[model samples]
Target: EEHPDNPGARLFLGLTLAQVGDLDGASREYKESARLAPDDPFPHYFHGQALHTLDRLDMAIREYREAVKLAPQDVRMRLNLGSAYYEQGIFESAIAQYREALKLNPGDAYIHYNLGLALADQGRFEPAIAAYKESARLNPTDPLVRYALGVVQETKGRVNEAIGEFEAAAQLAPTMAAAHAKLGWLYYNKNQVPQALEHFEKASRHDPDDAQTLHGLGLAKLASGKKDEGILSLKQAYQKEEREDKKRLIRSVLVKVGALSH
Candidate 1:
């Protein structure tokens, strides 16, 4: 209730709403803050954060860029800008911004994680692994980073190491669907079909609507000699899936199991 025209108070109100996960309210406050003082950068920066939370990636990018222009020396803004680019599928641009931020804050674990994602998108497996390793070193408690590293390790054919990372990730974050899925895949690749099925079941249980987990469960069942049940689950996953890529994943599972029928 500071003066209605106080840009700083409006900015703080916007940021407070953002911290509480009220994206729309935060955006409204930020809009008012921006209008109150167009020269101030905090409103625009937090506005970008609110828009990003709402999945308005393009608008978030524009706002973040404006924030960067207003406060060109703020490395954190550059990092936020990089993440916005990453979410929008601009990997190279994301990397560029992240590295710039890194120049200003070399030890930021989140930057390492974001850099790893950009590198992985480019198929630069070695660099991605290095980046992920650095992030894991810097932030050992973050299960999401561990899970991402495990998935990348699996993609690079390091099955045993991947399994270790996935199991650790699962232990740290029991609710992480991706860790369960990766662990299941790791077990499957090691010829431990029963173990694979157990993990797949866990993954699917945690995220029932995840078609990939369902398909994974189906694959594990098939590999363990339950073809009929496997095919049924695969068929369900195929029908329930929404994205084209996930549909393709279901089809691949079906092919591996030798059918796509009722």
Candidate 2:
């Protein structure tokens, strides 16, 4: 109360309130801070962050825009604004902001990764791959980046490149079920039954209830001449699958294999 007119004091109080999980109180304080220090970008930036955490994205974007206006060259402001846009599925705006951020800080690996995501979402696969490659170059050991790159490569029908990326991702994070699953599917498609089985088993160990993994395991087993085991895996996959079309597909496979009635 003694520092009622002090914007900095209100900002600190907002931070403290946020730490204590009193987001409403923090927001009120942040609002007051911004009002008191209308010319200062920090208050608006902090306010935007608080609103973003609350999932009040439209309001957050307003505050972020204000902050960006006050501090056009602040990469953090641009990045946060870009993130808000991305979460709202405003891909074009997100891409624009991310591009602006990259121009300001070209060497930022995290920004490059985010840019790749936005580009990939827009189906700009070539640019997305370029952005992901830059991010992978900047942060060589990041498994998620490798996984994302692998997914884009697979989408582009570059199976060999996808396999290499998924392999690198799996090596970096052994328990990453998605990487194992991708590797299993890729190897299965190549008729490398043993390798497919190995990866499918690893994927199943990490994500036991994944229907796609179970389906791949079933197919791999069938290809390797384990008819009964393959049929059982197919049953499990049918039971676990949530999609009607996929469940029908599994049922058809079972019926074709004489494991189910026509």
RMSD of each: 4.7, 1.1
In angstroms, give how far residue 131 of model 2 lies from its true place.
0.4
Query: Candidate 1 has what TM-score?
Result: 0.71
Deviation of model 1 at 198, angstroms: 2.6
lDDT of candidate 1 over 163-231, digit per residue (tens):
989998999999888788878877887889998999998898898887777787888888888999889
> Which candidate number has the best TM-score?
2
Question: How well is each residue in 25-108 modelled by candidate 2, as lDDT tens digits?
Answer: 998998999889999998889889989999999999999999999999999999999999999999999999999999999999
* Model 2 residue pairs with clashes: none
TM-score, prediction 2: 0.97
